[model samples]
Target: MDLDMAQVRAFVHAAQEMHFGRAAGDLGVTQQALSKRIGRLESLLGTKLFERLGHGVGLTEEGRRFLESARRALAASDDAVATIAGKDRPLRVDVWGHLYAPTRTLLQVAGRADELRLELGHGRDLPGAMTALLRGDIDVALGRIHPPLSPGLAHRLVRLEPVDAVLSTDHPLASEPTLRPEQLRDSVLWAPGALERLDFLRRFADRFGVRERSGSVNLGLAHFLTEVAVDPRRFSLVPADMPLPDIPGLRSVPLVDPTPLYAWSLLWRTGSTHPGLSTLAAACAGEAGRSRWLEYDPTRDWLPDLPTDRAEAHSG
Candidate 1:
């Protein structure tokens, strides 16, 4: 008998959640609708797959056995669809912060501009972007990550960009050819809350003895510049390659002593076999090879081992 993929999907979700209501919600279907779908699936298989409990559901032995097969079947179906319609479907990519220009350039140079529909996610910080990638909400992500990189995801180094100190032109250190972290001890550094969550930032802040003030996620570039412009005592850090908003009062100065670098990576699901993903990876590898800005050494682990206290502090 021909089995319905929708019914299989409902069964899989229901099995995973063990709560019909939650599974239905996840599938964007009403509880009653989900119940009917599961019922239909059980009937098709000529066996009960779940035991309805007082508060929740539990899978039958047959269901436990069938789950593996169901998952494989669903994955196969997805692969088939992707293979057939991949070019027409948008390849969702998440670009953290202001690295959009370079990433767009890479994609365009890869000849992906015409072949793949590009859905770009901007403004998401690294953690948020990685979460999206893990959830399969997006296909790829480009961002600076302090690694001990998460398991089950694959990544490639796009570049190691020098982190710059962004300060008001009036600030004492603004005219210095470059800055040492120690020089900023008297100034308050402003970073978005998301950026501050990074272990690298936490270590950098602690080492430098600089006070960090974090702006809320809703703070736009204009507001950020205005905040810096009004207060010479406030500064911020950004990737040197990032184009600063032409806010008249702000200047970007390179950081020198123990120069910190922002490592940008292209990340995707570890075992993803999608042709589009492979194409993008190949392009990134090629570009990294040819470009002077990109440092191509996958063997190097850039994330420093965080002390217990520092790790706990940055965990937030």
Candidate 2:
């Protein structure tokens, strides 16, 4: 049978995205067209490649195995085209969310890559970053990936860091080296975005009975953190290891009992062809294993229901 590269490409993207619509968008084709291509491919192969999911799509066992060969085929084709065209370019990447120093995580990724050429940028938040990814502005993005993400994007969780509260050293709670969630219930939850936009922080505040919430314009982490230090009743959280500037009277304290963790994921367009995409994934996975970046204990940690849970559900 003559294989259609278009059909093979559709299958690979749909398998990666787990969504027919997303794969179609990446291919710049209508979803119906993408579906037809895959259907034709399946008919030719005499095997079903995908199983429809209620919310998206999934790979059948055959589809999963077929993906390995499909990728190799596409890689060879891409390499041949690249060789003829001489269109090599640096991989563009970005990070979103302001609370944590994205550089800390990005540096780790760069460190593990053998030979890397990158063009780095920043996104305002997840929604903003999602736009950049959809527009092809960046090859990959690093940030929290709480849904509702656009179907055009696919992601892999790479980091989960325990969070700590930042407040004035003068705050009554600051006297304690470690505080628990309940201790902050009476204090204001200071956040950089509208609570509606920062769902993770909103969920956290609601779960821990933090009634009074406050928002600050994200001038930057240092400025927002300084505001936290100025108001004894206001507190904000950051990834535990993110270094804070030496703002006088500001103190960072760990939360015990049930610590909340900030989740980070590497996101990309489902059909991205950047050579650095896999290198970044391998680096993130390797560092996660070495640093226990994705480790979590339900009994000891607090996290909002995340995309990983839904992904696991889709597979099941």
Candidate 3:
């Protein structure tokens, strides 16, 4: 009995995305091709794996059961192929902090890398991605890694991104070329979730004397910026390098005199040999050096904690 790995892989992506068009885009295949691949896979398995839904696809019982086995099969195949052709298998990577467009860091490195084949997903946040990492659901994740990572995980500090203060054009400080963190004390710290749970913002507010806070849902960057543009007293932070949407009546001002730095790290499980691990790390290192991404000055910049140890050096 022989199974086509391509068909299996197409099915896996379709299952993960639950949207045929998105799955096709992820696979770099046309939608028709992806649908055909899924059809072939279902025919070979003699089971219906997905139910057509009004919006996206839903996994049937068979698909839910087969997902685990499919992942294992891919892992086994990847491991076997790594001995000779590691680049052939796609390395699963997850990223978070979409509000800041984390892919700006990833795609820059990915554009320069030639050795790695990647499949990227948005894990939404650090905690979510960490859970997936511990469970072996992904090969790598890129995000802000705070301390207390689970055992068997390793991390490499990849980038130090300087964040800017986003405020309404009507804000009193908006006209200033650069504002200090202390200036935000007069304004409300708008955020997605509770201030206590938002580690970075909470710490920043605690240290900077921002006592007032309020915000809406944790929507994407545009929505958050739009919300900021609504009130002159509300402000938030965003990566300075990220491209901002052309929303009306919003201004992004740089926060100086110890600017907050969002540390982006590459995380993976230790002791499990994934061939692309070293390749991806090397690629990140290369891009970091070429782009000066890891530059952090204690006097001019701020981070919640000191730099994390590189791959295999430390784990929680």
Candidate 3 lDDT trough over 10 residues, lowest sum: 307-316
lDDT (tens digit, per residue) of candidate 2 on 1-316 = 7788888988888887899998899889999999999999999999999999899988999998888677667655654664456346767888887568776898887887867677888888888887666545577898888868876568887777789989998888998989998899999999997888887889999899999998978898888888888988999888888888989989999998998988788898776666778878888878877887777777788778755633321110
- Write down the lDDT of every candidate, Cα atoms only: 0.68, 0.82, 0.82
Could you tell me which 10 consecutive residues in candidate 1 have the lowest summed lDDT? 307-316
Flag regions of model 1 displaced more than 4 Å.
1-26, 35-77, 98-117, 126-128, 147-151, 194-200, 296-316
Q: Is candidate 1 or candidate 2 better by TM-score?
A: 2
Shift of residue 88 alpha carbon in model 2, Å: 2.8
> Model 2: runs farther than 4 Å from truth?
1-87, 309-316
Pick by TM-score: 1 or 3, better one: 3
lDDT of 1 by residue, 166-283 (tens): 8998998888988877799888867655554655566667767876546545366667667777778888776676666779888888877556655566777655556667667666
List clashing residue pairs in candidate 1.
none
TM-score to native of every candidate shown:
0.69, 0.71, 0.71
Model 2: pairs clashing at backbone N, Cα or C within 3 Å = none
